[model samples]
Target chain A: MINKATEVFVSRGYDGTSMDTVARELGITKSAIYHHVKSKEELLHLAINRGISALDSAVEDERQRTGLTALERLRAAVHASVVILIEYHHSVTLLLRVRGNSDVEREALEQRRKIDDKIRALVAEAIGEGGLRSDFTPGLITRLLFGMVNSITEWYRPSYPVDPEAIADAVTSMAFNGLEA
Target chain B: MINKATEVFVSRGYDGTSMDTVARELGITKSAIYHHVKSKEELLHLAINRGISALDSAVEDERQRTGLTALERLRAAVHASVVILIEYHHSVTLLLRVRGNSDVEREALEQRRKIDDKIRALVAEAIGEGGLRSDFTPGLITRLLFGMVNSITEWYRPSYPVDPEAIADAVTSMAFNGLEA
Candidate 1:
C-alpha cells in the first residue's frame, strides 16, 4: 500500500497529491491506510529508505569483493547502482526528484551526498594508481560522472528490453576512452 | 511586468502556476496581464523564444566563421550557448523544464535536436582530424557533452561571481581529460 502511495507521490509530486488520492489509487479507505501508516510523510520516508538501502547494499557488496582494482570496483559499484535503479524505478525516481524541501527530502539528499563521496574516493584511488587520467580535477570529474549516470534515469525505458549491463558497459567504455576516429 | 511573470512561471512551473498568482506576485490585476499577453501560454512562448533564438543564432554565427578548425568552431559554439544561457536565466530555466507536452514545447524540442545535430557534426569532423580520441562512440560523446552543458541550468547560480567562459573551459577540460594520476 505504501509502495502504491510512493508511485502516486513520485508521479504527481508531494504537494499536488493527497491521502485521498493515494487511497483512491490503492482502492482502499483512508482509515485502512491509517491502519498501516500514520501519515503521507511516513510513506515518503519508507519509499526513500527502500531506495537508499538498495543502493547502499549494492555498494557494500561491491566493496566486499576482492582482487579488483579501484577502477574495477568503482565500475562494479556503478553497475550495481544502475541495476538497483532499474529494479526500483518508481521509488528511485522519487529519490531523484527530492528537492531538500522536507525532512525526508533532506535526509535523501544527505544519503545521496554520502554515496557521491564514496564514488569520488574510488575515482581518487584510480587516479593515484595511474589507472585514470590525472589532468582533470577530481571534483569536476565527480560531477561529470554523476551527471552522466543520473541522466540515464531521464531516458531509460524498461519496455525496450535492452540489457542493463550493456548500458553500464557502454557508459564505462565511453568515459574511459575518448571519441576520436 | 513580463519579467515578474517569467519569474513566477519558472518558480511554480507552467501547470502549477495560475494567472492570478502571477498577478498577485506583481501586485496587479489579472486583467492587466491579459493586456500584455492573450494567455499564460503566450507568456511561455515569449519567454522561451529568446533562449531558443540565442542558441540557434550562436551556432549559426560559429558556422559562418572561417579559418578555425572544427574543434575550435565547436568550442566557440558551445561557449556561446553557456554565455547566452547566463544572460537569459529565466527563459532557459523554462526551456529546461519543458516536457514537450504542448505544441510550444514540441517546437522547442525540435529546435534543440537541430542544435544537437549541428554540434555532433563538428564533433565528427574533429574526430576525422584526430583532435579527439577515436575509441569511444561519437553518439555517446555528443550526448555526454550536451548533457553536461544542459545540467548547468540545474545548478548554475547567477549570484556567484564566476564567469560563464570559465565554466565552458572547465567543462571542455573535464570532457577531454579523465581523472587519473
Candidate 2:
C-alpha cells in the first residue's frame, strides 16, 4: 500500500495526490484506506519512512563493519546507498522533492541531515587516516559523493541492462578514481 | 519580475503557485501581472528559460574556447555551469523540479535534455582525446557530473563565505582529480 502510494506521489506531485486517488488506484473504498491511514499525510509519512529506514540501516551497517577501514566502509556505504536508492527509488524521489513545508517533511529532512552527518563523519575519518584527500572538507566531499550516488535515482530504469551492482561499481570507481586518465 | 516569480515558484511548488501569488509577492495587482503575462505557465516558461539560456550560453562558450584540449574545455565548462547555477539559482531550482506536466514544462525538459547531450558529447570527445578514462560511458559520467553541479541549489546560501568560484573549483577538482590521497 505504501509502495502504491509512493508510485502515485511520484507520478503525480505529492501535493496533487490524495487519499481518494490512492484508494481508487488500489481498488479499495475510501473507508478502507481511512481504516489504515487517517490522511494522505499519514501515507506520505509511512512511504517516506520506508526509504529513510533503509538508508538508516545502511548507515548503521557501515558503522558496524568492524574489519573495514574508514575508507573501505565509506566505499561500501556508497555502494549500499546506491542499492537502497534503486530499491526504494520512488520513495527517494519523493524524499528529494521535500521542502519541509509540512511537519512530516521537516522531520524527514532532519533525519536525512543526520544520515548526511554520519556519511560526512566517515569521510572525515577516511581523510584523517590518510586514505582520502585532506584538501577538500568532509562536508563538501560527502555532499558531492552522495550527489553522484543520489543521481542514480534520476536516470536509472529497471529495464536497462545495467544492474545495481554495476552502477554502484561505476559510481564508486568514478567517485574515487575520477574521469581523468 | 521573472526573478520575483522564480522566488515565489521556488518557495511554492509550481502547481501551487499562481499569478496572483506572484503578483501578491511582488506587490502588484493581478491585472498588472496579466498585463505582462497571459498565465502562470508563461511565468514558469520565462523563469525556466532564464536558466536554460544561461546553461546554453555556458556550453556554447566552452565550445568556442580555442587553444584548449578537450579535457580543459570540459573542466572550464563545468566551472561555468556551476557559476550559472549560482547566478540563476532560483530558476535552476525550479528547472530541476520540473517533471514535464505541462506543455511549457515538457518544452523546458526537452531543452534541458539537449544541454545534457551537449555536455555528454564533450565528455565523449575528451575520452576520445585519451584524457578521460574510457571505462565508464560518457552518459554515466555526464549525469554524475551534473548531479554534483546541480546539487548546489539545495544547500548554497549567498551568505556563506564560499563564493561560486571556490565551489566551482572544489567541484572540478573532485571531478577531475577525485578525492583520493
Candidate 3:
C-alpha cells in the first residue's frame, strides 16, 4: 500500500496527491486506505521515512564502519547512496521533491538535514586527513558531491538498461579523478 | 508583477499559488494582475521565460564564442549557468521545481529539456576533442555535471555573502581536479 502511495506521490506530487486519489489508484475504498494509513500526511511520512532509513543505513554500512581511510569511507558512502537511491527511486524522488509544507514534511526535511550534515562531516574529515582537497569549503564540496548523487533520483529510470555498478564506478571516478583528460 | 508572482510561486509552490495570492502579496487587485497576465499560467510563463532567456544568453555569451576550446566553452557555460541561476535564484528555483501539470509548465519543461540537450552536446564535443575523459558516457557525465551546478538554485540566497566568481572558480576547479588529494 505504501508502495502504491509512493508511486502516486512520485507521479502526481505530494501536494497534488490526496487520499482519495491514492485509493482510486489502488482500486480500494478510501476507508481501506484510512484503515492502513490515517491520512495523506502519514503516508508521506512513511514514504519519506523509508527513503531516509535506507540512506542512513547506507551511510552506516560496514564499508563505512570498518577500518578505512576517511576518503575510502566517503567513497563507500557515495556509492551506497547512489545504489540505494536507484534501488528505491520512487520513494527517493518523492523525498527529494518535498517542499516542507506540513509538519510531517518539515520533520522529513530535518531528517534530510541530519543526513546532509553527516556527509558534510565526512568530507571535512577526509580533507583533514589529507585525502581530499581542503582548498574548497567542506560544506560547498559536500553540496556539490551529493548534488551529483541525488540527481540520480531525477533521471534514472527502471526501463533504461543502466547498470548500477557502472553508475557507482562512474560517479566515484568523476568525483575523484574528475572529467579533465 | 512577474517578479512578485515568481516570489509567490516560489514560496507557495506553483500548484498552491493563485492569482488572488499573487495579487495579495503584491498589494494589488486581482484584476490589475489580470490586466498584465490573463491567467496564472501566463504569469508562470513570463516568470519562467525570464529565467530561460537569461540562461540562453549565458550559453551564448562571448566567452563561449571566441577562441575557446571545447573544454573552455564547456567551462564557460558551466560558470555562466551557475552565475545566472544565483542571480535569478527564485525564478530559476520555480523553473526547476515545475512538475508540468499545466500547459505553460509543460512548455517550460520542453524549453528546459532543450537547454539540457544543448549542454549534453557540449559535453560530448568536449569529450570528442579529448578535453575530457571519454570513459564515462557523455549523457551520464552531463547529468552529473549539471546536477552539481543546478544545486545552486536550491541553497543560494541573496542574503548570503557568496561571491559568484569564487563559486564559478571553485565549481570549475572541483569538476576538473576533483576531491582527491
Candidate 4:
C-alpha cells in the first residue's frame, strides 16, 4: 500500500496527489487506505521513514563494526548508504525531493541533517586518525561524496541491470582512490 | 530582467512564477519587463540561455586547448564547468531544474544534453588514451562526475568565503588523486 502511495506521490507532486488518486492506483477503496493510515501526510511520513530508518540504521551498524579503522568504517557506511539508496529507490527519491514546507517535512529534514552530521563527524575522525587526506575540509568532502552518491538516483534506474554493489564499489573507488588509472 | 526572472523562477518554481512577480521583485512596472521580453517563457529561455551559453563556451574553449592530452582537456572542461556553475549560479539552477515541460524548456534540456554528450565523449577518449581508469563505463563516470559537480549548487552558497578556483582545485584534486592522505 505504501509502495503504491509512493508511486502516486512521485508521479504526482505531493500537493497534487489525493487519497482518491492513491486509492485508484491501488484499485482499492479510499476507506481501505484510511484504515491503514489517517491521511496522505501519514503515507508520506511512513514512506520516507522507510528510507530514513534504513540509512540511519545502516550508519549505526557501521559504527558498531569492530576492528575497523575510522576510514574503513566511513567507507562501509557509504557503501551501506548506496545499497540502501538503490534498494529504497522511490523512498530515497521522496527523501531527496522534500522541502521543509510542513511540520512533517521539517522533521524529516532535521533527521536528514542528523545523518549528514553523523557522516561529517566520521569524515573528520578519519582525517584526525590520518586515514583521510586533510587538504580538503571534512564538510566539503562529505558534501561532494554524498552529492555524487545521491546523484545515482537521477540516472541509475532499477532496470539498468547494474548491481548495487558494483555502483557502491565505483563510488568508493572514485572517492578513496581517485579516478586516475 | 533575465536575472530577476531566474531568481523568481528558482524560488517560486517556473509554473508558479509570473511576469508580475518578477517585475515586482525587480521593483519595476510590468510594462517595463514587457519592453524587455515578450512573455514569461521568453524570460526563462533568456535566463537559462545565459547559463547554457557560458557552459557551452567554456567546454568548447577547453576542447581547443593546445598541447593538452585528452585527460588534461577533460580536467580543464570540468574545472571550467564548476567555475561557470559558481559564476552563473541562478542560471545553472534554472537550467538544472528544467523538466522540458514547454518548447523553451525542451530546447534547454537538449542543449544540456549536447554538453553531456561532449563530456562523455571526452571521458571515453581519456580512457582510450590510458589517462583514466577503464574500470567504470564512460556513461557511469560522466553521470557521477557531473552529478557531483552539479550538486555544488545545493550547498556552495555565494556567501561562503571560498574562491571558485579553490573549489575547482579541490574538485580536480579529489577527482584525479582522491582523498587519501
| lDDT for position B58 in model 4 | 98
Tens digit of per-residue lDDT, candidate 4, span A1-181:
8887886787787888888888998999999999999888889999888999999999989977899998999999999999999998888888899999887799899999999999999999999999999988888899989998898988777787669999999888898888889
Query: Distance (Å) between predicted and true CA of A121, model 1?
Result: 4.0
Docking quality (DockQ) for each candidate: 0.38, 0.73, 0.73, 0.87
lDDT of 1 by residue, B1-181 (tens): 7666777888888888988998899999999889999988888888888888898899889966899888778777877877877777788888877888888889988888898888888888878788776554566567766766776776678764457777666665556543333
Lowest summed lDDT window (length 10), candidate 2 chain B: B12-21
Candidate 2 vs 3: which has more TM-score: 2
| Candidate 2 DockQ vs. native | 0.73
Instruction: Kindly report the interface RMSD of candidate 4, rounded to 1 decimal.
Output: 0.8
User: What fraction of the reference interface contacts is present in each model, in order?
Assistant: 0.38, 0.69, 0.71, 0.84
CAPRI tier of model 1:
acceptable
lDDT by residue for model 3 (A1-181), tens: 8887898998876777778888999999999988888788899889888888999888877345868898999988998898888888888888887777899888888988988888888989999999998888888888888888887788889875669888988888889878899
| lDDT, candidate 4, B1-181, per-residue tens | 6787788889888898777788889999999988988888889999999999999999999987899998999999999999999999999998998888999999999999999999999999999999999999998889889989998988878787778998888887887778888
Q: lDDT by residue for model 2 over A57-146, one digit each (tens)?
A: 998898779988899999888888988999899999889878898999999999999999899999999999998988778987888888
Top TM-score prediction, candidate number? 4
* lDDT over C-alpha atoms for residue A67 of model 4: 95
Evaluate candidate 4 and give its CAPRI docking class based on DockQ.
Answer: high
TM-score of 2: 0.93
Q: State how far residue B12 of model 1 sits from its true place (Å).
A: 3.4
When summed lDDT is taken over every stretch of 10 residues in candidate 4 chain A, the lowest stretch is: A153-162
* Tens digits of lDDT, candidate 3, B37-83: 77888888999888888998888672358778888898888888888
**For residues A33-109, what per-residue lDDT tens digits would candidate 1 score against the true structure?**
89988888888989778888999889777866799888778778877887777677778878888889888789999
Off by over 4 Å in 2: none
